[model samples]
Target chain A: MNFPSKLIEDAVTEISRLPGIGKKTALRLALHLLKQNGAVTEALALALTRMREEINYCKTCHNISDHEECSICQSHRRDRSLVCVVEDIRDVLAIENTNQYQGLYHVLGGVISPIQGIGPEELKIESLLSRITEGEIREVILALSATMEGDTTSFYLSKRLKDSKVKVSTIARGIPVGGELEFTDEVTLGRSILTRINYSQD
Target chain B: MNFPSKLIEDAVTEISRLPGIGKKTALRLALHLLKQNGAVTEALALALTRMREEINYCKTCHNISDHEECSICQSHRRDRSLVCVVEDIRDVLAIENTNQYQGLYHVLGGVISPIQGIGPEELKIESLLSRITEGEIREVILALSATMEGDTTSFYLSKRLKDSKVKVSTIARGIPVGGELEFTDEVTLGRSILTRINYSQD
Candidate 1:
């Protein structure tokens, strides 16, 4: 991994710090950047510079944004009466891509992981509580993952929001749509069976 | 792919210009960079900035170096009397990694591909010619690929060095060691057969 010079070595080292990028791949990327036109390379560099310089966390949702408030929070077309609480901006984007979720989103930044020394205090739980107390929120959907941390967070939030008049619900979990009965695992099959709906006429 | 801001979009677009980086991968890389510490991100940005601002072509060897001479050319321990001409710095690294070749290298930057509009003038052909005439040169090895373009370049270089006192040679080609003959194709088998060595007592 001995580079041609200190500058080239530094660049390669920095590139190798990126996720999944080894020294060889970093060197390849660095060499490609070196060979290209000055403006093109500078633009890529400026992106990294500006991302560090200009980007900030959205004060309302804790999502990465250019402004104090995120675009979803500022949008007029989004429903203000309903708020969907998610783990991250990735979840917000995923919900947005469905086009069915018209309500505004609240990014929790991360789930409650006790092992990582992160509790409710580290999350945006306080902000979420304050937002719900604004009196117009009719429902608060917990759109967290089905992992242990996600479950713990959902349980804590549900208990916290129990006193409020706003209805609390979670996204459904069971056998996936179009899944074959033979291929269904025992855990999923058990859950599906337990949550089975009664379709008999009264 | 319409992002919230044009700056972010432009950044992703520029990053996608790198080899093997598609729009999604570019966005991932950009986001990862954004998530990094300000100083770490800025260091990469600064490196990319200076790669264009400071670095230039080495007049003698055509390799990317900080000064007029590349590291290989400047090194006194290298076999200066023998020159290994290759397509790019990657080839130089390949030879260096072997720790077998101690000769100086001449990076052509690219091969003479007429279809790609890369002619002899586009490469460092003149620099190579000048190096050969510098005296004390004993051998000129064409450490190029077996591709059509690589062969064409090797042929051109061999012809140009015909009048010189230096001995010209190409790297040996045959089935790799520990390779199975049943798996080997007819062309490689034929070459191995043609260049078959005698197993008689020394």
Candidate 2:
């Protein structure tokens, strides 16, 4: 589409570069920004630039942080011995929102995807191994996704940690809490059946 | 959702303010930005800020431009005697894309919507009237939408311009090309029949 101004065209082009946003949506967003106060744009620009330029990652967990170590990693209340390994900061946020886990996290940054040219060396696997070998950690929970990449990364990590004293486990996979058995995929159903827990006597 | 850092959270909040973007989508976008090269974020920030801060509007047409007078208004090829009135710059772009209209445009900025507290004085209608009264203009084509606000603005403009000698016309409304008559709505179908034109004998 022909734009009246080069500035608008440039803005649209940059905005559409983001995932899931198309040219039309970018144009709409640019126009929306024009309608708002100048301060809004200023704030948005500053926030994005500052985050991209100045944001740090936790030295211990490799999660995004404003300081040398992330808040979770620095917190004394968090169980440092129980580390949940995840793919990226987004997964960290998701698990943190659950409030079910009080342990620290080890963000792998990404999975070992050969198709994407991301190997074990590309992730924070070395740091994770070093952290485990430092010897206080009792359990290392593999909280990655159920995709092929996730499985590959988990298998690799387990093989690497076999000699270590840390007990390695994976997050349980099954039908979602509100999901129906009929709608569940066959593989998930079969796995759920095989890994069924015994009925509690309480 | 909880973010790992304040910068990420701020960026997410600002990005989510755009139309059609929610918190989850904003978070996803922010994380996507974080994963990309710093140059991408810098370029995006620069484009957005520059567009918002330095963009100009055409004085004559009120369409967005990089200069005081828009390219259409400054061009000698377009018909000076004909003016097509539209609701916004988007309509101007749409009409321009058709490559059929040779007339200049008068952007209303927005329609007269009392429900939204918008009135004639709030739009660029006064400048349009002055342009018309300055003489030599032969036709004023109302190319606004088919909505209630469009009709109201058109009616108000026509009534105000009744004393003028310029011929005022509206773009025809009918069943869209390739639209099935069976699926057509009653009001449009009824109007189309009432305003039916005769077949050419040639």
Residue B123 shift from truth in candidate 2, angstroms: 0.9
TM-score of chain B of 1: 0.90
lDDT per residue as tens, model 2, B1-202 = 7677899899999998999999889988888988899999999999999999999999998899999999999999999999999988788989999999998999988899999899999999889889988996899999989999999999999998888899999998899999999999999999999988789836
Global lDDT of model 2: 0.92
CA shift at B51, candidate 2, in angstroms?
1.1
Provide the TM-score of chain A alone for each candidate, in the order shown. 0.85, 0.96
Backbone clashes, each candidate: 0, 0
Question: Model 1: per-residue lDDT, tens digit, B1-202?
Answer: 5465555677778878988788777777777776557788888888777776887666777777777788888899998888888998778877888899998888888888999998888988887888888886799899899789999999998998899889999887789899999999898889889977789949
- State the DockQ of every prediction: 0.55, 0.83
Candidate No. with top TM-score: 2
Model 1: CA > 4 A from native:
A114-118, A146-152, A173-202, B177-202
lDDT of 2 by residue, A1-202 (tens): 8998999999999999999999988998998899889999999999999989888899999898988988898899998889999998889888988889999899999999989899989899989999988888999999999999999999999999999999999999988899999999999999999988779946
Q: Measured with DockQ on alpha carbons, how good is candidate 2?
A: 0.83
The number of the candidate with the highest lDDT is: 2
Score every model by TM-score: 0.86, 0.93
> Alpha-carbon error at B129 in model 2, in Å?
0.5
